[model samples]
Target: MRISLMSTTLAQGVIDWSRDGHVLTAEQKKFYEREGYIVIRNVVPQYELDRYQKRFMEICKMKGVAQSMTVMRDMTIARSEYVPGEKAIMKVQDFGDDPILFDYCKYPAIVDTVKDLIGTPNSNLLAMHTMLINKPPDSGSLTSRHPMHQDLQYFPFRPADFICCSWTAMEKITRANGCLVVVPRTHKGPLLPHEYPKWEGGVNPMYHGIQSYDPKMPRLHVEMEAGDTVFFHPLLIHGSGTNRTNGFRKAISCHYANDDLCRYVDIDKNQEFTANEILDVARKRMKKYGMSEEEAKAVQIDFADIWRLRARAVNGVRQHL
Candidate 1:
């Protein structure tokens, strides 16, 4: 299919968006504006899909964790009786240490898409943290679920509008398979504070009462196949239900910010948290890791290095450049 680029020519003294057209279709822009999210289907290739699947499975086996989502498969339709083993360990966040995962996030198509969405090519890398939510069949493991929250709420940054998230589905995601559900049009309002009581110990808390512009409106479920990806506004309320299809639902999620958007502001409180905050926090955390305070304080937060370490990652050669 031929996708047309909307030549909304960037004027002098104005931002130029023409370069990122491949990923950001004219129609997708409208969807983003109206609904606060957009889904791009079949963006990842079949071979790339298989390649990552094999790698993830191998990693799971190495870590002695559940390799598939089979254990929690029955939870989608009804409560499942299963528990997870103790050997499960999350990999992929530090994927840069692994060449295969690092190259995968750097795929041309993926980067181009991110460029289109971001409207710039010089956008540096964000950390490509990978995760494998492996649940064995009928093991009575606590179901993995995400609370309906915006990315900017947890992310300390400014401008609140420039950052974007790339979610690449590695496993076939469905309603029964536990895909993401988003509250459409919620990205325009102020961020809300959240504190939920423990719904069940060892399980993520049941979050409620985040400030919403339209709580009465219905929620939108985003069901996608492998290779499909969804990009949403930072403030778009989103989360996923439990995996009940008895298989693993693995995905690579990366967050990206424009290089020019240097100003960081807290989305909920609208308070500014500069790049200095990372310097301060990293220093403090280094102490716990057995580093001296002087050493930690001297650790600079390279925005480029930070992006490469923090942006999105999937199995294939795809990334946000």
Candidate 2:
């Protein structure tokens, strides 16, 4: 593995897990500290998973949507003739408007565990980003394969350690179905520079990646069954392979933050920040929906504004961020 000096140095130190109400065992804490992630088997119940699965299909089958949820297409396959309409859907955002998804996000099993990892006694926990990813199979698109990168790149929040993600498998995940692949201990290193992938056919610039991925990093494929959840650090270098199977690989994930510890960074000065990339995406979507340039200009909002609307206090008290 090509280990940077900073990562190597951090790996040699121990992570402090001191907290008011931690639920992780010593071993689990150690694993997260050393590897920047942990998979808690069956953290979500099967009944809950079934509910979400059913709701997801219902949404997919709906004909006309009137603004409650945003359905995003796989940019890589959006222009392709092979995938059309809802079949091109890569993710469903702002689904929290649905009671089922909202309740699931606040489910004690998920909240308590997240609190253990990145919570504080005096503050609340916020669900910063929520989405249901559907990695379609047999589509000749790069959407199924995410480039190696850190989650923090897209987030404007400070103190990277205060942010984390809980990704739950809604169905069986395997290497053929694009299971998550992560590089251990990468979270301990500083946030590296990121740029949009320069693929010939084009890519979803919203999903930024490292300038160049080191092939020798200690990468691991994380396969899981339904109800299994993986909690990972925001800075962990991770991505997935293309789905070679005949079915879609489905997963629901929410990025969380310790509201007390996280605050938005000044994006205006940080021209390279990924928040700028996300804003560009929003503008493109607006234009794609047939909005005139003037119309888009009049209503355009930055990524932070969009995230504020999507965020919800899942535990303790609500925080204004």
Candidate 3:
């Protein structure tokens, strides 16, 4: 199915956005348009969640093989003290090459819902970013909090209406254990500037956040149960807090785009900071892979190329990222 989305008209300092539903019911579409997100009950089944958990453990134990995947340890644990690998690993990114983890991206329920929300035909849906997050216990470092930010801050794609994220709770998530917190209706506003939060201890690399926002804006703590999935717009301002509990808070997510509709854009004047930040990261990673500084500079991997490396078609034809 194909539908035109995101006609905008400004009024009273906010832009009104519109969408048409395919798999979504009338009420669900209405809710998403008003709140910037919708939580679908049990979109991920227990069996799939179990498999993901098991695969995560296997990777932690050094038994899984996914050369393209990256395992990120918590900043505190990475900088100090010896903890078992399983406890230190805080996230896994770009796991599309891992057979077990890749299944989450291809899952029909998820792919269809994402396609519906983005108003894109199933033949052109792509999963551009995937991450399995394990919010570790605070351990006094306070690094577990993902500061408030828009997912669009990290993306270079246009037609924000054609991009969405599917986040599934692998275990029950409550406010006490760092559930996702969102600013309602923030997606109706324009893209805002982002920078690393001025945290006292530290934050994980590339974890930039909105530097300023209205504190009085109503906050919604998204308490979710295992297997529950929330589909949200890329411009929605959301973040997770610290995990005060003893166990790791687990969730898996994929950011999907209408591959046929969304195309790369140069970072607008407003987003140059994040673009420079990403360029530094890309070059550093290149060095980690054995490229000399000059060699990495010569490669000229631009912003679009970085996303192209991560984009993988889940439900559709490959097209411009």
Candidate 4:
């Protein structure tokens, strides 16, 4: 997929600028508005990071070796052979079911900044998605290189500006360790066409990429230390490279939305929406649960329902039911 860049436009302001209790400085907000993303350094406490890392290992042990493949919040986890000695557990999706993971999502520094970006002091916020990614070194697959795409492609929400993502590094993230790369100001544009990347073996249908991404666009390599975080718009074009280094690169991320400001789109009738990947996952889950097509339809449970379940409220209240 290749997208051509035509012109750059400033992001349309969706923030409640009059709101108080904002933690971001004026300059930081300005930068975010201009670039569609902002990196906050050392916002996560070292102790918290360490605790979460330990908890991840503990969960891996609890899951046991026999549970090599487990699905959580749409992310797929598997044991990796790339790591020497002990096999490294690669967790790629939802961490909402875990208490420690939920704590990280509501971490004050993270949620405060999120409120500054997408909500007023009184606005309710929802933790829309969560993932704890462990990228194994030399995977030699698309698993490492996340193709550039907009997060909104999979979301069934409205008013993209009301949604944001907080991605925090659990350890030093460098280009060698597959740090994030983002196309600046891309969020100001509408969502582009998305398609599965051309890769051998089966690719996770949920992993969609922009059908057209122009290389000429202004791109940034977001390198960071442990506890550093980046809050980005849902429509921002971004992805990561391969971990060329010799160890596992780990990160925890969660998407957030102003629950009072966003609503669910009609996926079945919305011509502008492309959530085939998410729909496919819902279908598979239905089958796994022994739900026949008629039963699924009878209950009115499908991709949108699955996504709604994924959207858990971590702060204030959830407005969209």
* Candidate 3 lDDT tens digits, 136-199: 9888878899989999878877678778899999999998789999988998888888889889
Cα RMSD (angstroms) for every candidate in the order listed: 8.7, 5.5, 4.2, 5.8
The local lDDT score (0 to 100) that residue 200 gets in candidate 1 is 57
* CA lDDT, every model vs. true structure: 0.54, 0.75, 0.82, 0.73
lDDT of 4 by residue, 28-74 (tens): 87777678899999999889998888877766555432211233321
Candidate 1, residues 163-244, lDDT tens digits: the string is 5667778767877656888999877766666443234523432233244334456898898988888877677888776656
Ranking by lDDT: 3, 2, 4, 1
Give the Cα-based TM-score of candidate 4 against the true structure.
0.83
The segments of candidate 4 whose C-alpha lies over 4 angstroms from its true place after superposition are 1-21, 62-88, 200-205, 267-274, 290-299
Quote each prediction's TM-score. Answer: 0.67, 0.85, 0.91, 0.83
- Global Cα lDDT for candidate 4: 0.73
lDDT comparing candidate 3 with the true structure: 0.82
CA lDDT, candidate 4, residue 241:
81
Off by over 4 Å in 1: 1-20, 61-94, 125-142, 201-216, 265-321
**Lowest summed lDDT over 10 consecutive residues: which window, candidate 1?**
1-10
